[model samples]
Target: MSEDSPPGLDLARLRTHLDAERPGLVTGELRARVIEGGRSNLTYVVEDGTHRWVVRRPPLGHVLPTAHDMRREHTVISALGPTPVPVPATLLLCTDESVLGAPFYVMDHVEGTPYRQRDQLVPLGADRTRRIAESMVDTLAELHAVDHRAVGLAEFGRPDGFLERQLRRWGKQLDASRSRDLPGVDRLRERLAARLPPSPPPTVVHGDYRLDNLLVAGDDTITAVLDWEMSTVGDPLTDIALLIAYTEGEALGDDLSSVASAPGFPPVADLVARYTATSGRDTSAMGWYLGFAFFKLAVILEGIYYRFNQGKTVGEGFDRIGASVAPLVARGNAVLEED
Candidate 1:
């Protein structure tokens, strides 16, 4: 791909269509580049030499019908505009596949750093780091507090049987991509099924909530909570469990995406407590949720491994992803041992 053109985008055609659809949308020559490090959707930073914006589209080639719903992402961002979630301001959503070869949308590009490494946070010291971590929980509580019905998202997801559907979704994903025998996977899956906890009232769950997914400004405040591809109305505890599990893993020297192990970050209990106080949700049954989080992550990584095996994966780092599955399965089983 040339420097002038980003892969998966036809800038000339797109700009022409942009001007027709929304006049004056493109002030100058449009240029785009795929933002690296995103594992799922292809995110592009688009510019017109004056204003910058973000464009999101599904990855090229085969895709599941419901997986990369551009409309879903845009809808959620638009709904959360009046909420305290700090999502980027959405501009336009295009379902016309003729424009970008696939459905895509544009949003105002916010400035901030997604601190993915421990070294990046070390200079900030403990207090600032702790504040940032605390803010994450507060933001999550704020997000869960938003009523879907009030926000006109009552049909966003069927809250009934959410956990059961989630289990089946990941199970089928793992089976579809079972390239090897990960010993503890079946056992963990079975235990999760047999010991499923009754879910609390459904709230909008950010299916993949984590620190790196958020854009933090210099003041350590979250400028925008990016990435809502896995979002749905479901058990809010699932969101809490995932965050705790991620921080717990990082505390154990596991990098579960981001430098969550950095000094000054609050403990898992503290985060849960803050959420409980802020959102007034019961988290006593979190052990089961945390175990399920591990199982879900294992299944996800195994799928990536399967893609790598078929040589369908692009770029580096994929070689090391599949290896994390086994350990995650083991972690899943270990978490359940608390019961």
Candidate 2:
């Protein structure tokens, strides 16, 4: 691997670029602070005098192919601007690598706390928790309802091999990022390969639709649906399955009497029922997608395990990530084998 072009951002260069691009929008000393949690992209909240903006660029050291494309991320969010879906208004996109070390873009900085710490979620009580959960589901539905062609996303992800690419792509990612040997991953891969889910009409799929990925406003409405780096044209049900996997008996922990068990959540069955009723899409192959969703997440977390072992990641809980794989694989297989 080639040496990375240094890890820190060059503020002097960034100030010069912003001056040429927007002139008076940002003036004075540019303060750069690093934000955590992103593995593929380097994000920073750039504050200049009275103005604040967000910048997203490719990660340092090494990056995966087709990952962290700032232009693609800018395009999708900009396209979604006119839609009812909530997203940060993208201001400017710069493909000129000379401006910064790598391609980066600027957008309006949204002010809201993200719910990443499981213990910090505050439960929001039972009723509000269910409302927030439903809003998350509904927001995803709205995204899928948008016409890809009309929204200028017709050339997005390939529609033909949506499911196949997902299965193969994530499977390959696991192989690349694996730090330790886990036999269940192989077994799950074989089962998925043997009985691939039937193809469905492709719709917009948020590659990582989950609770933490969204921002909640009052009345349980989703003000901003973020992290569109993985958004693509694919089976809409795939998004549903991803959302369910993030919630189903997981967020609330082993005990069912937690905040996620409120009346509003509607369980997995109810969530799917509501989604099918709202979209009028076929819901027959939900089981396959649900299992596939877990498989994909397991692969991703395992990658985090790899990074953690190498001392490249922050936070705790890397060791226990491997434990979640077996259960997820079994759940996926059970869904496939069920009558």
Candidate 3:
């Protein structure tokens, strides 16, 4: 192991375990570096000077209950591999904590770019950018159209009362990480609880869906849909609504990482229309879903803020994250009022 390996990953132990579990996988001395951009899970790019792979695990500390489940992420990706959904080929799921002090999994390294900011899309021009964004929406529709039962994911999640459980779960997460007062947060939660929209037939839900979560190839194709820590079988509309929130929300500010604001990226209404046309799902109750999406993002950012304050977060770009929480709460209330 190199002396400068990132936190929460011991290369020596990792290589030893890999050699024992899957012999001859590592050919040479193993080297690894942290892959940034993910806020909840810690991703690392490991290499043996011949082959490259990606590793995923829970954050360093202050992990909330039932959050960042490595087994769930691995299972979903593995299940969706045979489907049209693009996911890395899973190599191994390590549950033995003695190896890494936390459960982790490894998969083949995919080559693509996760465009975060609008400027990053500018170089691609409007036509290419539009094609990539539309492909993103289409990919999401394809995912919602998948038969969870056919993919052997019938027992993946409880869809009976998904919305109510999601609201309560995120509320509990906020309470667990409450370190500072947030205005309008209570009002937002109450409003959401008061007006629960009847969910359409449940489908696989990617709890966090956005452009940055997708890796795009040079041909404007979505190579893979990454980040499944919050994924499960739930209302499909929740997925699209969350995508809308990430695209249109003002909480993160203009300079923050939002490729949706780039030129030629479809607007919220256009994206919604495309999804409706493709998935044949009714979007009449999208207003309420959008409100809930903002609330969920606010709670997520607040949790990150708490972890950052405690010096538990491992990456950069977290300093301005705390300020985005109040704005997100405000946006949630505003969306509900407009609805």
Candidate 4:
């Protein structure tokens, strides 16, 4: 695993926090095994004898506002407990600043391998890969099916102007954090703004829905959909668009490697068809949504590049991310112009 943080756990701080959260459980020596993969947060699998827990806190270094909100992270998973969505049970949230210099939350450590790149899913046959991909869709469908009001998510995000706010919010992030100038960021933003999708009924939108962000069981099932930090109530198509973006038009196919190969997984057309059948939402704007997804990802990657320049992050192939942004903006532009 990538060493995303300093070697070994912060033994003193870990013990202190765990002591307050679970009395007497902090006794004896405690060792922390860091979990890698996230670019914006610190996840560790903490162990003390027979007890095991997962602690998620802010990134190793400074971060921007609206990024890495542990409270929001813990709240969404907690709210999702009664829902059909599979989520790790939230155990405790520590807002005290002194413990680790930032708020952190502990939840039951879930067991499953992360399904990120096409390489990870290669062991499973094409049919199994299709099943896994469909399970991811099904989980998302069920999440969208939940009653937001009944689940106490009425205040999760403002319903009105949901689409407008998202575009505006991410636009600001792009402007605030891009290391280098992307060729068509401004043009794509302008075009996307000019031709925004029609707002539909508000539903939970997993701001980031991709293969890597989810965990899969050996049976090719999505046991848990991790990373709820960016989740909010908004246009449901946004989530579908995200899936389209990651899968890059080959959503449910075989040869699941690099997200570029084609053949086995369901194609974007079919994936959208299945989702439409399950979600019962209008598919008229799906093309527009897919364009928006591509554009949004480009902007986010550019923002990471921006952060890298400020001397915040290093490595992980971010230096070359600027190359991906222009194409994504162009893709968005094409979608808008074609429609």
> Relative to the true structure, how large is the alpha-carbon lDDT of every model?
0.82, 0.72, 0.89, 0.73
| TM-scores, each model vs. reference | 0.94, 0.86, 0.98, 0.90
Candidate 1's residue-wise lDDT over 1-339, tens digit each?
234777677888778767887799789988888787666678889899999999898866545436778999999989998887899999899999988788998899999987667778889999999988888899999899899889989999999999998988888878877878899898898899998788888888888787878899998889998889889999999888887776765533343555666889787788989999989988898889999999888876676667667765544577777767777888889999985
Model 1 is weakest, by summed lDDT over 10 consecutive residues, at 249-258
Task: List the lowest-lDDT window of 10 residues for candidate 4.
Answer: 249-258
**Which runs of model 4 end up more than 4 angstroms from their true locations?**
1-9, 24-28, 249-257, 260-263, 314-320
Candidate 4 lDDT over 1-339, as tens digits, reads 123334323667767767877788655666676665565566778777777778888765546668778898898889889899888888889888777777888898777777656665566768877877777788888989988889888999887988788888888878767656677778877777877778789887778887767777776667777887788888888998788777763332221225435225677778788888988889798767776787788766666656656656533554665556666777777777777
Clashing pairs in 1: none
TM-score-better candidate, 3 vs 4? 3
In model 2, the runs with Cα more than 4 Å from the true position are 1-8, 98-100, 117-123, 249-264, 314-327
RMSD list, candidates in order: 2.0, 4.0, 1.2, 3.6
Superposition error at 92 for model 3 (Å): 0.5
- The sequence of per-residue lDDT tens digits that candidate 2 reaches over residues 139-161 is 88888899888989999879887
| Residues 1-339, model 3: lDDT tens digits | 347678999998998899999999999988888998788899999999999999998988999999999999999999999999998999999999888889999999998999888889989989998898889899999999999999989999999988999999999999999998898898899889989888888788888988888889888878899999999999999999998988875336742356776789888899999999999999999999999999999899999989999999999888888988888888888888898
- The TM-score of predicted model 4 comes to 0.90
Order of models, best TM-score first: 3, 1, 4, 2
